[model samples]
Target: MTSSPAAEDGVVRADVWLWAARMYKTRSIARQAIDGGKVDLNGHAVKPARSVRAGDVFELTRGNERIEVRVLAVSERRGPAPDAALLYVETERSIARRQAEVALRRQHAGAPRPPGRPDKQDRRLLQRLKKSIRD
Candidate 1:
């Protein structure tokens, strides 16, 4: 299937676009992820050069989780503070669900590890760390 050509101004790498869009933290990580088949656009796997347009839906997988995001604009380079925000939009529902999960996980993550057999040294370290964290 033929896709539309990239904007005449310039075509940016898909990975770069994702990073600039704040979908990913770093361009290299984005490219590695794409090359590793961790990224998809409109249900189709894409290389790093595939042109990105507004309203593009991308499914990205990292570790054991996958995320769906929509594009709002494309830029050849990462834009400045305000302009950078014109990049992509994570659906509200997606945001809510993800935030909820993160909140729940964080709640548990911050809890003390199950009280099991902790040797004297282990217990002391755990206590110190927990105390430090509390402080």
Candidate 2:
């Protein structure tokens, strides 16, 4: 197999790095995220082809979670989870914030929900509440 450009140089494309690091499932998805402005390098939005080097900081949002990582190595080939883990280090602040957000979600998720569809009386109350808000 042909070696990737990153094998020769110390830099790799941002999208490729993201996929290789397991941040995104595939390179195309990583490219899409970059194009959508969901990925940033050194605190600024970067294109998929942007060159990423060791020690560069990347902040990206994947679904509801925001992740920040510092690049430790560069690779273009997608690897195992453990290998991917070696590519970057998530900042401690990022880990703390993610944990806090997860805890908040867990707290809200503990709220009891109705077991089934709303009863007629419950639906009526909801309709009245909606009408009042529109008025």
73-116, model 1: which lDDT tens digit per residue?
77766667678776766777667877887888888887767578
Summarize candidate 2's per-residue lDDT along 2-74 as a digit string, tens digits: 9866667988899989999999998999999999999999999899989999999999999999999999999
Candidate 1's error at 42, in angstroms? 1.2
Clashing pairs in 1: none
In candidate 2 the C-alpha lDDT for residue 65 amounts to 96
Best candidate, TM-score-wise? 2
Q: What is the TM-score of each candidate against the true structure?
A: 0.65, 0.92
Worst 10 residues of 1 by lDDT: 1-10
lDDT of each: 0.78, 0.94
Pairs with backbone N, CA or C atoms under 3 Å apart (clashes), candidate 2: none
Clashes of 2: 0
User: TM-score of model 1 relative to the true fold?
Assistant: 0.65
